[model samples]
Target: MESPLKNFAEVARKFCAWAETQPVSTENEVKTAIELLANLSSAILATSNLGFGEDLEGERISDEEWRVTYNRFGFLPFNYYSTFFNPANVGKEEPVIGDLADDLADIYRDLKAGFWLYDRGHVKEAVWEWRQSFQTHWGRHATGALYALHAWSTNESIQL
Candidate 1:
């Protein structure tokens, strides 16, 4: 059987490829995004805790590049949603605005970093990159984006 890390890499690749297509906010695109995000989220969890590997430097994706990715999803029906910085502090704290585009872009950027290492025959490093980033970063974006996308999908009143 293939390793869980490999499985996650596959899912990440699929989601990244779809994002690279610069999907619009058409009904089909929305559906696809929802499904892919869900799949990616689940796949990420399956990797659980991975062992650390050699630390390798990778090229950083510039903010301008990220902005281009964000702009691609301009056709989305909604971009902003209200969420708490910490859900546990819900009643005590004010909700902050979360941007779906930002969530997607961050997820893409994090996964791509792991993909860079994995593609270069550094499986352990790639797994470490993914697991670490997931725990510290992309995991939050994935959940927030999933929640937002779920809201968008279930509401029939919101047109694509």
Candidate 2:
């Protein structure tokens, strides 16, 4: 059987491949991509929640041990969001680590709007708006956006 970490990595790779093919100009395609991204994000969070193996005593290990375990399992490398998103790093300074986190937040905002629209029975409009927002906000670092999109899609399917 595959481990949760391995499953999460596989799903992430699938999402990235799908995102690359998503149509930036089409409303429906973008909406679908966003939904897929949301689902992918949820899966990653779930996997992370599983935590690394614990000792028989069930004590939490140090950060270094956790990192080593995660890395050894072929998980995606970690990055600090604070280092990437801090504005001070943009001009004369270097960018912080949380840049991807910032982008993910933007994607989440758009996804929330889309979710509200769908909840309000305005699926068509919601889809259109999400596509527009995605076009405006999506960048080379599309991981977060994709995760949000996947979550949205999966949730909708479950509801139906």
Candidate 3:
């Protein structure tokens, strides 16, 4: 039996691969990808609070590579309303456009980092890194991406 961490890692890996290669030519394709991401995000958060530890060696893909893959989804129009990252003090929600390709890439970048560590056999580091980043960062992007994808699929006639 696979460990929970490995199971989650596999899901992350598969999602990344699928996202990168999946067809976006039709609404059905996009909806399927969105569903995969939403489920992945939920599963990630479910186990995020279950551990604590130091991270091991890990690496990130080149920014160029990230942007390149991000560009592949350029054909997609991933638009959503974004809140100001630091609006609590202002007490005003400044709305902005959130791009799904960019946001999805952001989430995938973090997941790839975790995947890197796990692939290299640093299991503890992978889980720690994933949990910490999920809590601190990519979780927002993942959720936002899901929302944008869903809204796009359900209401293609409307842009949010």
How many backbone clashes does every candidate have? 0, 24, 0
**TM-score leaderboard ranking:** 1, 3, 2
For residues 41-81, could you state the per-residue lDDT of candidate 1 as single tens digits? 78878885657767784445778988887887766778999
Q: Model 2 over residues 11-100: C-alpha lDDT tens digits? A: 544543443342343335446445555555554445433222222121233456434433332211222333333344557676544343
Worst 10 residues of 2 by lDDT: 50-59
lDDT of 2 at 19: 32
Clashing pairs in 3: none
* lDDT of the structure predicted as candidate 2: 0.43
Candidate 3: where is the Cα deviation over 4 Å? 1-3, 22-24, 48-57, 79-91, 157-160
Q: In model 1, which runs have C-alpha deviations exceeding 4 angstroms?
A: 157-160
TM per candidate comes to 0.89, 0.32, 0.80
Candidate 2 stretches greater than 4 Å from native: 1-77, 80-98, 139-160
Greater TM-score among 1 and 3 belongs to 1
lDDT of 3 by residue, 40-142 (tens): 7767766644455553646887899789768766656554456556546485666667777787777778888888887787777888888888878887777
